[model samples]
Target: MAKTLSVAPKQPQSCAALLEKLSSVLPKGHQFGIYHLSTPPTKTDALCHPPPDQRPDRTYCENHFLAVTIKSESKPSSSEPHADWRPVIVLALEIFIFTTAYSSIFFVSKADSTGYLHLLNLPKGTPSPIREVSSAFLAYLIDKRRRKGIQTTVNLFARAQDQYLFPGSIKNGGKHVLDDRGLVKWWCRVLDPLLEEQQQKQGSPWQVVKGYLLIPGLDHYETRAFIPRTATSAANWVLGHPLEKISHYCQEYDWVPPRCLIPKYPDDPKSRYRDELDEEASNKEQNSGAWRSVKTLEQFWEMMSFRQECSSGRMTGFIWVVFDPKDAEVNRGRVGGTPMPNGTPDQAPPGTPSRNRHALSSATPKSSPKKTFGSPSKQADLGRVEQKKKAKDKKKKKKILKGPIIPRQPRIKTRQRNYLVDRPVSSAYYYWPAEGRGQKIVDESDYKRCTELLLRLDFATLDKAAGSTRRWIEEVGMGSQWGLDVQGKMEMPPAAQGSGTAAGVVNNLSGLVRKKPIEGSEGQGQNGAGVNMLGAGLVRKKRKESTDGAEPNTDGSSHPAPSTAEEPKVNMLGAGMVRKKPKLA
Candidate 1:
């Protein structure tokens, strides 16, 4: 007969053994919780059961719960051989749960009527995944707590709730929701203090704070709390350049706030957002009042934070020199060798001597005739030699007097074209006097120094200096036309008209005829008065008669005219007929 093997029923696995198995398989940095189902399926004793309504109701229990929360650990238990296997099973389950959670967060097959949550597939390279996960976990925790009607508050949960909700709504917590501004504010509340602490510890401001603040969602809070107090400090944080360099550049270029020499962060998204914000603010101001009318710290921050578009294909921090029309005219004057109005012939600039002086010096002096008893041939030779010498001297004098023909400096043809090869001289080369007559000359070395300094300045430095300059302009009452007009109220005589011109003559004659009655001729007949009409015709007649040698009556036939000293000076339509020099005494 075949030997029969009897098998005993298999025993249920112990919880410790299961836990050990889970611990072994789980990946590092992962935690898993295990719970037993409180409601196990039950079999009914149908034979003894009465009718359905009279039978004990077994429809459903009001509450189903999990028992014993257990977490998987990375370390294996030494007491059991299968300890390492437990965490692996737990890790697999955890992966499934994590994937499910992420999928639900991103892509939902159906919409929920609750309206508290939304599902959106985030763009490929967003930084919101971690935050989203945290939010979802918080939501789950809040729901669990509410279901239990628990009144206890977890500080971490409270903080997360505040970060996820609108300001002042955290205490009246409901569901966890993401509020961008609130999140940014929360970040500032945490990071700003940390930045300050780091600054204190390092004995200098932290540059990383600027980078953190400029991250897309966080930059909105720049003016709200995190920006450095001073422009120089902000520059140092935003741009890795010295404040002095920026200030010097601004001073050189005369660039005020919102008109920096260099464009900053033109391609950065944060910068772009800041620019949008600035543009919005600018538009609002324009609509509500004057554009950029109010100079506040808020405005300053907006201006500094804005990024300019470089359609010119220039690099960030590139220096652009602008030549005003007046500057170009002045430069042209210098290149053309024009003499200074105040300077005399003796004081003419070198290489540009006075033309009159040159003419006088170049004239040939007359030579006395030579008295010599010489042969005819010798005389002829001597004469020829003298003529040749004279001609040579004349040519040399012409060359000397005319000097070198220095060509005019070439002008930049168009404003749009950049002069990469021929950059403009720096402001230091031209001294701007407080009196504002015009720029004066300076040494070449100073110009070079200023140019190099300006070129070295980065965007942030220039931006900071611009803001400071604007503030200074405002403080000195030069920001608006009204303030400038008030400062420019000094009286000045009306500009003189061109008296020699026909139009000017007519104007002057009309004024004289209207205002002044001709002396001793008031009662003259209309015919005689018609000839005496104050105009170019009468003036021309008087001039022609004077030039043709007509003499003024000194025989007292004409009425005694006013003395030259007493006669009022008048234009007389370009004719100077002031009572012909009164015979002395």
Candidate 2:
């Protein structure tokens, strides 16, 4: 009940007729041009040999070879219609080259069948001629190649717009080409299906092969057969050969020598093969930006092995495959009830919750404190308590002796000078009396006598007296008493009154002469020294009494009794020598 499908066959065109058609459509003065260069006798004999057994059968394809070249007129009149056809020719050449470069080769069994001559690979960007030809010729050849199970090497550098160059394009006739590492990954993804189909077809192991071919639009071509190797030795042998050795082998096999194999061209200094000896030097500069330094063949092979392992999904030692418990059980059950491999445990029985074995194994256990055996004796306990009490009492005594803590003021340590050694006895040693002291001490004789008294003191006593006096002056804002200036001395408050060294030194050194008490001076003390009590102690007493509502007897006579806050201010010298005030009242 099957119906026979009949198709019309394509008619062939003569070479003269085809040229005439192309010339009519081309610009004025432009004609189809063809040049034939006969191959050398040695190369012709090599080409006549049959292809290797591993290669695809090409018996169905036409063996006839022809090379087409279209030449454009060199010069044309500017005024002529459409005179400048250079741009058009260039565009057509690009299309022709790109199409032929990537198009698959086709084979025909009949001599009369249509087939366009395959062009040799050209160097990239090389100038070429073009002819106005139908793309139908290319489509016909690809169709025949598909029906005959023939394929061409992949073109990685083809234009992106050429969809047939892509691996999964419909125009590729379901054939694949592994041209790059990315396409290798694509191949790996569907490798299981490919292998299953191959097994089903009972095909030879080397029946299908991937090709990596790079053909620059120049005389040079690079091609490699990607035969699958079952043994590691075979793969290693293929990849381990040096590029130069491989080029030499190809030359011996009647293949055109690659740019890398040729001797340096005398006329062309930029020739690629001109400097083999300089490779190491040039590579040292060129590989500066490379990610890895590949210096040894062993290291290179190791890196390649790692990359191949990664690409083929063989590096699974670090990859853990976790599965749902239910799914894992189902998979295990489907596999003829076989136990899980690699010590993988089976799912827990129904109704029993699964425990996380990893979490339990990794958990740390808590430790408990150890216990003592017996209680201490009462006597020992009492002795311990007594010792603790004694320690507390000691701390209390130390705190009491330490007195109230005072925060230390920030100060810079300065170099201290010893007057006895650093300098001779000067006026700076004289005791400068405090405010309200008797005028007798201000005399030059009194200052000299005071300095002599100070110089006579023992070393220890002199040091004590100097420290106390320096501290008092610093406290009372009278550092000039010690011949110290504000810029050179530390600012500090006066010392407390418990120490009497400073007061004794000031009293003796000043050579103060007490005045006789005048009549009517209340609370006057003997010796009339109360008036000279203008030193630090008396100032503190007067300040305290004044705050208690007592009028200070500035006449230097005696301490006054508490009185009313309102009192007339009196100016007085030591020993009640009162001075008269202005009568503005």
Candidate 3:
């Protein structure tokens, strides 16, 4: 029987028993159960009735940190376990958290360490423990958060690398780890099933499981393989990266720099030690370096390029996986918006109508302005009204949007492809600032089509993965414009458009049902990696056939010939051959 998932394992013994089965693949001491690094959230800590100051502590979604270790232990050509089962890691997880009744989760960075985490090779056809542990834990976190009644989109980065636990790629003989491209696909495949969890339910909070990939200097021709990536007329989904915030600040202000060497934040749960360091540095006047001299985001990236971890020839993919809430947009920017410019004139705000041109055109002309000295309240109210009008005018002027010179689109002669020329960068083996500028605003239908295609893709092999991408573009791109003006009053996502939403994973004793495949996706029941959309963990991999000119079995796998072995007393059965190692020799 397939074991069901539990978001929060209530019985420690049962959880321990289950984990013990996976002990060989789990990191040492972490094999038993999850270790929480954060305090539980409380109800009183969420957004106040009327939204209060935008601070992390009182945010609607509370951020939390989680860490886990896993690795695939494949055998080498020489009939031994693949070397490099353990290599020094630099965490690719995704970051950049939460507490209120609703907790937002992100993997916290494990500070400054470089080393290998040993791997124990499991029986052949076993999936990589690394992907398993990571996926399972992430699913657990999502589910736990869902149970808390916190419905918000979850955002995190997924940069693929050999390992993510350590800072630098240590020189290890292990070459079994997936490369950057494979890592991204592998992550996608790993997380793809999560979508099934939401599609299974009518009111499932986890609505989408979309991915946004930004590899610098990649052109449309190259990037077309990964859905529509750059910004177009429709919706610019390629929101800027988090690191660029530092740069934005520098550009806006003559910002005195902090320790820019590491991308640690003061409120980061794991990196609270940064606060102590800041205090000490201030007391001793010891904070000084090129870090202090930095001014712009470009300089930040330039410096980041030199870091031991990033300098490696391996390109780090800037990826975003957003588990969006259909009704709950977690971003504080749009929440509790200011009542939309105070509605129409009839149901106008409960104040003196403004003397602005728009209001004056409709307002009944007052016979004479009754500005008596006795009525200070009216005068004061009028003065306040004038200030608000002035501020509104300034705001409008500041954001004066120039309408398109050619209002309606010119009639298509043959058919125009998307305008794919986003600002390209000069790739110089470094992470440039604004790494995620290639934006695209896919329509809802296109977005759904692309995500479905991506899920159907078989990333089992390079050839399959390539073929899948070709199929994806051919099918999803047919009659689909990458740029289309959003016409409806749709609940569209902001700048980060390419993502699918999956707010929480199935954490408890229930399996998610995969949604009925849409029309064309029915035949696309392809599989990648050893994954079940239900995320029950430890699924068996379908081993490949040998390339040595042997015919594969009817099952698409080649069975190894059994070796003959002698029984000490009783004779062993026919075909069950297992011989004493080279008896004559």
- Give the best candidate by lDDT: 3
lDDT of candidates 1 onward, in order: 0.26, 0.25, 0.35
Which lDDT tens digits does candidate 3 get at residues 440-497? 3233345446444544544333233334434544464464432111111122234322
TM-score for all models, in order of appearance: 0.16, 0.16, 0.33
The TM-score of candidate 3 is 0.33
* Ranked candidates (TM-score, high to low): 3, 1, 2
lDDT, candidate 3, equals 0.35
Candidates sorted on lDDT, descending: 3, 1, 2
lDDT of 1 at 164: 17
What's the lDDT of the predicted structure labeled candidate 1? Answer: 0.26
Predicted structure 3: clash tally? 37
What is the Å distance of residue 174 in model 1 from its true position?
15
Question: Please, what are the lDDT tens digits per residue for candidate 2 over residues 256-344?
Answer: 11222322221212222123223533543322211123332233333433442233432211100000122332222111123323233
How large is the C-alpha RMSD of every model relative to the true structure?
49.8, 54.8, 31.5
Clashes of 1: 14
- In model 2, the Cα lDDT at residue 111 comes to 10
